[model samples]
Target: MKGKEILSAIKKDIDEHVGEKVLLKANSGRRKVMVREGILEKTYPNIFVIRVEGNDRTSRTISYSYSDILTQTVQLVFKNNNVAI
Candidate 1:
């Protein structure tokens, strides 16, 4: 699926499971790594970001945490035809 689709899916999943635990996963990419890292950058204990990937293309997924964050669910806002923060 496209990045926007993936992000929307993630946002929905997060809202559906509030106050619970959730996991995010994606294929190998610099953007994926950045998202994982950003999620980990929590000042206080809240959410957790896990990286899950495989050596081969057939098995690879990067994950992001949504249940821990307190912000409202946001869609994958895009700018310049690319994923926007």
Candidate 2:
């Protein structure tokens, strides 16, 4: 699929899991990997956001471009053990 098509699909996938917990797996791009469990916050035209809370009780928002999903640079897992994006 083309970029726009893939982006649309990713957005739809995210929308489906709104208000649900998901696993976000991504490489920090510096040889380190980061994985977080958070609620699928919201989806935008260009990017989607996740709400992650650290052990210190600090909540942070992380956003990723749709391309990240398409390239598999980021993986999103639904609570049902299904891969969303």
> Over all chains combined, what TM-score does candidate 1 have?
0.25
Backbone clashes per model, in order? 4, 0
Worst 10 residues of 1 by lDDT: 35-44
Question: Judged by lDDT, which candidate is best?
Answer: 2
Per-residue alpha-carbon lDDT of candidate 1 for residues 1-85, written as tens digits (9 for 90 to 100): 5754654655554344333222332333454422221121121122333332344534333333443222323222222233332
Q: Assess candidate 2 and give its lDDT.
A: 0.85
Q: Which 10 residues in a row give candidate 2 its minimum summed lDDT?
A: 1-10
In candidate 2, the residue pairs with backbone N, CA or C atoms under 3 Å apart (3 or more residues apart, or in different chains) clash, namely: none
Off by over 4 Å in 2: none
lDDT of 2 by residue, 1-85 (tens): 5767878877887788888899889978888889999988888888888999999999999999888988889998888767666
Native-structure RMSD, model 2: 1.6
lDDT for residue 85 in candidate 2, whole number 0-100:
66
Model 1 gets an lDDT of: 0.33
